[model samples]
Target: MEEWERWERRVQTAAHPVAYRLMRAVAARGPAVRVPRVGVVVSDAGLARQVLTDTEAYTKTGPGAAAALWSPVLGSRVLITLEGAEHAALRRRLGGLFTQGHVAGVCERVLRAPLGGLERRLAAGEEVDLVGVVRDGAAEVIRELVGLPAGGSDFTEAAAVVSSVRLWRRSLTGRQLHRARAALARLSEAAVESYRSGDESTVPGRLRALGLDEAEARGAVGLFLLTGTETLVSFVPRLVALAHDTGRGPDEITDALVEEALRVTSPTPVMLRSAARAGRIGGVRVEAGERVVIVTLLCTGAYGPFSPERDPSETAGLRRLWFGAGPHFCLGMPLAMAETRAVADALRGFPDLAIAGRRPARGVLIPAYARLSLRAAR
Candidate 1:
């Protein structure tokens, strides 16, 4: 394989924009452009729907490899990997906790936790690695929101260890897999203990009222944090980096710049689905058992046919799908977007912010800066 192809195969999951580009090329060109036997093509939205919505026909279950890799670590039934009524039931069960109002409340807290860290770094007259700052901040918020103990920094480290599994198609081994499972157990137990100790206010009252046994509730900690914290870590800095790289003048009205950045740099790349039943989609014949993916991040923005110029729609409304779509749409989207808006809004006051490194640092995945150091101007 060529170098770029190797990178594309190795690390780029749906989170990586390049994968979307490749898929789009195949879709537009025809099946012949893609590996014929692999059956990955993006040409027909019909084919896309087959993988995304046809839960019954495609059967997200395994004899296939993806499930075997993920089912043990991420519950076989977590929203992303689930199918049929099982997926619907879980979505409904968790609905009350992730309503708009609740998500907004969580965003408020996530936005504040990082202020002290950023301020301290600025006060010391040292350059800040925005990625590290954002990662730590997001990790802290996720643990606290899930009602986990902040006693040790282990939460962040454990989170990093587990997040590594996001690249499971490549480097995952039995040992790392075992660590991820154990970490989930630890985090879940802590969440259950915290809930019992008057920490019900941290999560939704309805969640606590669900009458889950301790272990079941604990198991949910990993699920919640995976969506809530990890997504923020991936997206927020990318937003900041885009704002900085695009040379949006600090005084050019922060809110507008933030909107542009969100539109320009959608961080979540791929949404996955299985055909509910065998049928045709986008004029493509989809076998009932096929898996399909939609690349919302890259395909929805100004680049694709869905350009905002012609669409004249606000990024916010359509941006919800940036989190996910259908019944399994992201539970933490409002919180994530609110936090992103707050972070960008705050940075607008720093008129001196500039790229600490090159403008467009390209990788096989999402556009990221090798170093996003901002010099907070006086």
Candidate 2:
């Protein structure tokens, strides 16, 4: 097979299996391989850091596919889009909200409320679709935190927005692209309204505290919903599935496992960056304005580099790229992690929990189950 064709085939494979394909590419051409218009994708973490963190060489560039969808919402300057000082400031401002106490408090509330109710239903011999249960739970935490109306439908609707964003970024056609933009705009407007009233203490409060005006708050909130929902929904079920497969009984399921799952299965795969200046990494030279997709999952585990034993904190290694790295690290990391762990712990308590049918869907960006069926303990 041709080199580029091999890469494309790899991209289409499952998350766990991507490493072998990556290793082959690294072997064939050594660590740095030309990914057509994407410049060079470095499999080495040190090299990736040089390319991504150097700032002078690589700039924060979204993948060719969703850049348009996101560019409008986050603009070319939010923490996700901006580089250097601007990105740092934004991250710092948002980081305060996810402090340990803040996250723990949210987790307690999540466990006490929706998650507790779901467990009760499951324990009653109810054939609960754990996917829907967990997805709705996570969605509620997000919406409540952000002040959105609850109905369970918002989770699916938000997922659609996320899916549309992915489709447009990849290969959406004219009409499809137009529809996606319209949907994003409508969602953005709704997201903004939830935070408008001074009485509301949603995510908009944080944006307002940051001094963002109405439109800026709308854009930020839209970005929050898009990015937040996908990660939590994707990880929550996988964590439960892992617990089921490992025979980790209620007693065995711990926050450690949840954090481990987050690290091991990084739902958010690539962190895209464009070269700011000419530079070389992984023994390959990159020119100015070149795009580089840093495969974060590859660096988190496997042969050498960033060992799990190195960081023994409650969720340290698990969150390696959980929020991403450099200037674009996620603003919602703390809340997402808290909610995911809470839901996982609650599900673990239901010993009879079994995934009925339907496998997960993997992609270049988002990864989750299309239909995660479930049945009562049997």
Candidate 3:
């Protein structure tokens, strides 16, 4: 196979085989195509931006991915289902926590112990399970921010199972759902603890200050804990692989590396938005109540293949699209970046880092490795 074709094949392995076929087919037709995939579909970067940033046209409330799946898990009127001013208000209220400086500092402190342990293990020439390392470290960061009780690895493990539920549920059978719910059931106590009395600096307290009662607050915290940590686990380790491929050493991590990984991984690959009003994305007219699916991965062309030193002009719209464009842009991006940076910094200790091997894709909801094993060059 040619090099580019070979590289594109890896993208397919990141998700279920069928999902990749759909994306490739739609993309070939251009930026936007409508053949009923939950609704109108858009895979072009310029077009995807208009759909996401124009909140008036495409609202997330109607049967889109998050509303469809998460509402079942978190109940109605949760942040993911809100639109317009209400959505803007809640995001604004919590915006302070995600500021660039605040997130960087807080990340270094909360993630220090776990990251240091990982660095030490790699230094001893151990084969590290990058997936497990990212899960434990990312979960601890979210656990602290959301006010979950400390100590046990249950939260991390449970979150790993719970987060992927969003991706594969549409095609999942009763047996799979039941098994996933059983695993997700472990988060209840942590939510209760946080909602009842977690520190004001955390989500539960802030939610309360914004008028959510204990029950509502508890459910919201549960949603974030389940959603937040797993997404981190999926992307951060992949960035390590990208780093090694680009010849980035353990001690070298650039802002460009963080940006490129976010683009390549495109963490929230598909975002579903229902049209609140009529709209045109790349000449395709979308009616009210129709859905617009933003395939961020293909839309960004997998961010034009990871570059160790990407130029700003070349990546003009990357940040807006990858993190999301407007009001509904990911609230957890800063936290996600912080953890990615930490992973990059830790990988610096290993002079030669490479994946130990690849396993056949595990059919995950999100595009991810079933296990990303790693070894240092001897």
lDDT of 3: 0.68
Model 2, runs deviating above 4 Å: 1-29, 61-69, 107-111, 152-155, 164-177, 190-202, 304-319, 362-364, 376-378
Backbone clash total for model 1 is 15
Per-residue error at 233 for model 3, in Å?
Answer: 1.6
- TM-score, per-candidate, Cα-based: 0.76, 0.80, 0.86
Candidate 3, residues 1-378: lDDT per residue as tens digits? 543235335744655577777777877887788876456678878787777778777777864546666555555656776888877766676666577887787688888887787777767777888887887777777666666667775565555455346442433345544544554455556565555674566667766776666656655666667667767767776666666556666556678766766776676678888787786788888887777778888877645666657677788766558778878777877777778878877777676776786542455566655567887766
RMSD of candidate 3 to the truth, in angstroms, is 3.1
lDDT of each: 0.53, 0.59, 0.68
Would you list the clashing residue pairs of candidate 2? 57-275, 57-276, 59-274, 65-169, 66-169, 352-377
Q: What lDDT score is found at residue 310 in candidate 3?
A: 61
TM-score of 1: 0.76
Best by TM-score: 3
Judged by lDDT against the true structure, how good is candidate 1?
A: 0.53
What's the ranking of the predictions by lDDT, best on top? 3, 2, 1
